[model samples]
Target: MSREQVVELIPALRAFARILCPQPENADDLVQETLIKAIANLNQYTEGTRLKSWLFTIMRNTFNTRYRKREREVIGLPPDSTNTLVTQPDQEWSARAKEVYSALMRLPDQYREILVLIVIQGESYEDAAVICDCAVGTVKSRLNRARQRLREELGEAVED
Candidate 1:
């Protein structure tokens, strides 16, 4: 694909990157880096595949690589960091949200990725399966397991 075509797809790429990277700045950087890589390796792209799918695959791979690298480099926050302060108006809701988020974080990467792709990002099972390079059944199974794990972590009773 040409650079202009890639440029036109930036909005969609940014949306996907936003969910992949919680930080807005990091999402922007990921999108930029993905575009650069796409342009650089344009020759490797197959003509039959959808460009959006190809681009999402590249973005996902780029995010995964960056996440692995960042995992090795940890910067500790000082005790007085503003993030330590409670700024929420509704402390009850905030606490519950934090608890759920913590539970979500505890799930395995495969489960978490599927949940994020299907539930959070509103992608269909087929689309998520394509993005994850798995079958639709695998996506459904992972999502079900992820939800069960989250419930277990949160101490919620599992229901059929």
Candidate 2:
């Protein structure tokens, strides 16, 4: 793929990164890092495949690596200190959105990732499977479970 093509995907990459990282600055950093990695390893990318999926794979891997490293290096912050980072929602919609986002954040990584990839990002099952390195059936199963879990979290009635 051409560099310009990759550049065009920055907005999409930023959106995905925001979902993965939450904090805007961190999301921007993740997108930048993804672009750098994609550029550096451009030769490894196969032609005639979805560049978005390939870049997503790289971003997912990068985020996972950073998460693992952070887990190991995590330091306990003063309990009250966290409150400083949270901003109170002003509007009703904002509050509801924050609630939904919080529920999403509470989901397990795999479930959350699947939901974001399929439900939020509008990725096809086949594309999501490729990005996630899983079978299509696995993607469907995870999506089902993720929806069920989200409904449960949101206090919606779930059908069997």
Candidate 3:
């Protein structure tokens, strides 16, 4: 992969990884593993295959393996239960914004990822599709649905 291509893929990888693992550190680790694996297997990548999708697949696969391992572990054995149920901060600033942000946060992680990719980041429909490992039409449809849900939750611009 070209240096610029790798650089461009970083944000997309992080976004996809974040959806897989909510913890920033775990997401970063996933990204690191993805980069290493992608580079190591770069020769296997076909010229026409979408690199973003390839990277996302690697990230997702890594997360799934980690998740499955965690799931398979015996639950009651861990004594490290201190703060196992970490909570979101109660941001006391601007109640309106906190409410709106919370609503957006409540969006299904899949929808939130699409919203971040398409609307917040202003990525092209095609690029977002590649990052999301879906078709261009699917990306467009998800973006529309996410926008509608955000609007509904924020109670603005309700249309027929």
Candidate 4:
């Protein structure tokens, strides 16, 4: 991918990072790490492929790696340090949006990733499958399960 093309995807990368990392600073750090890995491994990138999906795959892998590391490191630690104070939203829509986001965050990583890739980022099933390194049927199944879990988390009745 050209330098310009990679630069243009920074915003999208940051948005995805934010979803993966709830803290804004941590999200920015993840984006920076993703960029570093992508640039360092530029030779591995195939020409004529979707650069966005490639970058996303890198970001996802990076996040997963870091998450697993943190899980191991946090054994028997106090939970207070992980909690952040959130301010209440002023507007009704903003409150609703925050509620939805909270529910989304409670989902397992695979489910959340699929939802963000397909529903939020608007990636097609094929592209999402490529980014997620899974088959198209797997992606669709994950998306369906993610939606159902999200709705359940939000106290909504599941339709069939």
The CA lDDT of each predicted structure is: 0.75, 0.80, 0.69, 0.82
Could you give candidate 4's per-residue lDDT for residues 1-160 as a string of tens digits? 8889999999999989877776566678899999999999999999998899999999989988885455324422455655343212224567679888778877887889899998768898999998888999999999899999999999999986
Give lDDT tens digits, candidate 3, residues 1-160.
6768977989878876655554456667888999998888888777786777667666666766675354224222355763332223245758886676667766765678777766555667787777667898988888788888888888888784
Deviation from native of the Cα of residue 9 in model 4, angstroms: 0.2
lDDT measured at residue 64 in model 3 versus the true structure, 0 to 100:
64
Off by over 4 Å in 4: 71-82, 86-93
What are the RMSDs of all candidates, in order?
4.6, 2.9, 5.0, 3.2
- Following a full C-alpha superposition, what root-mean-square deviation does model 3 have from the true structure? 5.0
Clashing residue pairs in candidate 1 are: none
lDDT of 2: 0.80
Q: How do all the candidates rank in terms of lDDT, highest first?
A: 4, 2, 1, 3
Tens-digit per-residue lDDT, 21-124, candidate 1 = 54455778899999988988889999877787788888888988785355223212354665323221235567788787667656787898788776766677
Model 2 stretches with alpha carbons more than 4 Å out:
71-78, 83-93
Question: Looking at model 2, how many pairs of residues clash?
Answer: 0
Report the lDDT tens digits of candidate 2 across residue range 1-160.
9999999989889889877775555678899999999999999999999898899999999988884344323213354665324222224567678778778877887888899888767889999998888999999999999889988999899888
- lDDT winner between 3 and 4, please give it: 4
